[model samples]
Target: MNPFRHGLLAARTAAVMPHRQRQLATLSAEGNAPLSVLFYHRVADSHPNDWTIGCQRFRRQIDYCERYFELIDLAEMQLRMERGESRRPAVCLTFDDGYRDNSDFALPLLIQRRIPCTYFVCTANILNQTPFPHDEAAGQPLAVNSLEQIQAAADAGIEIGCHTKHHVDFSHVHDERTVRDEIIHAKSELENLIDRPVRYFAFPYGLPEHLTQVAVDAVIEAGFDGFCSGYGAYNLPGESPFHIRRFHGDPEMARFKNWLSFDSRKLRKNFSLDFRLPASRIPTLPVPTTMTPAFSVLG
Candidate 1:
């Protein structure tokens, strides 16, 4: 929010205004405008850190989204993708690491507004009432969400997803057994706590290098409806809907607007990882009770 950074963003916005219009026009005509999934970590006014955004700023962003975008959840986003191209751009809001501070304002606001969000939590932190390693390393050591809070969120209609047991970076994890334990067991533990089926999994430190074939394969084998990566990218139509791409929802409104506005440079940036899995390997998302699995490709 410094003046120089503000000026740079303004310059970028001016430069891309026309291009954004044309880009949206073309994509709208094509009927497959990209979907944006935004992720935030914490929402509070105290003990600020890289992962935290101020409550007022978070509210402003939500208001902006309410005005300019179609706010949907992951399941609805996937349903839209399945039905083929959509005419308008849509967004899904998600939070990572399950910080305790979100219960202060962010969660209550979303619940009151009836907005759809996926809240991903690391099981070990909640189970042990421990702080995230990153937060501890930053010397802030903020509180993490408790099991009761997570249950409350779920009961209020927020979708709780898994972020592994310990938030282990998959890039450094090579053993398949370890990956399976982290993912599958995490899902089971969360489900047990929430008493519902956990349908999604998000990779911790979700960059291309922070992900691995072993982890993604475990995600698929575990039958998660979809998986998410968090290195800031858009999820385009006609691509694999199962692999949800997300951008950072930091406090900077200019950057958030730029990313959602189809900034040409942002669109050109690629953040995909090649899992080399065949079509049959990727499982289909959940359907009605009468429906059966077709073993559709994950693409």
Candidate 2:
């Protein structure tokens, strides 16, 4: 590791250790929050690459989640959170931009462990077998699963959600008609394929500032049960079902361990504080770099 990254990790460790231990003790006595945490774009493959985790490390994270949280499906999580119940801190797993490797790598492990999960798929990608622009720019091809494979996963009890038709940035799309088409078309395509009501949606590159009121209203009109975003935070009672937060996990074992030991409040505080800083005035920390691999390879 570079000196900068090593020092950042050490500092973060030092800064958060007491808080983590205290939180754990409090959790043990007072019990965990009914908070529902969502995770996205997980992979089980190799290291030194962005967006992919080695199988060993992936297994370890899953194991940790299974132990620490009640692993529930998204629907169950939504229902429980909506009811204001103080259930254990539960996690719902989701993958954005349906990838074939999700079927190839992660699905097998999830199946073996009987853990339920959801996949928010871009309908056009699967329909046309086209690579996402970002992946194409990176000289990487998307690995979206075929319709048959998606059906098989559904048969195995995985829930499929809509991730729009073309993975376009709805913010840049000035045409409300086009945005509505993207939202409605994707859900229709998935429902046709899965032969079930597709009730969930995940914004492509979801961020609060970027996702506008019109877009949110469009999704609600389309009859989605909820929507999720890439934001990193925990969901509390009465939080907007349309804009949920998710944590980004590094495929590296040490980084994953550090994340697990982290206090959620500290993470939230750091992000909020960082967002308020002038871009040029922001301090850089030495920590494991964020993974940027193709969403498809996240298996």
lDDT of 2 at 50: 62
Clashes of each: 1, 4
Query: Whose lDDT is greatest here?
Result: 1
lDDT of 1 by residue, 77-193 (tens): 776666667666778899999999899899999999888899999999999989988887888888999999999999998999999999898888898899999998889888999
lDDT of 2 by residue, 103-149 (tens): 77787888777787788888888888887766777777757778888
What TM-score does candidate 2 get on C-alpha atoms?
A: 0.79
Task: Estimate TM-scores for all models.
Answer: 0.90, 0.79
Q: Which lDDT value does model 2 have at 299?
A: 10
Off by over 4 Å in 2: 1-18, 24-36, 42-49, 254-299
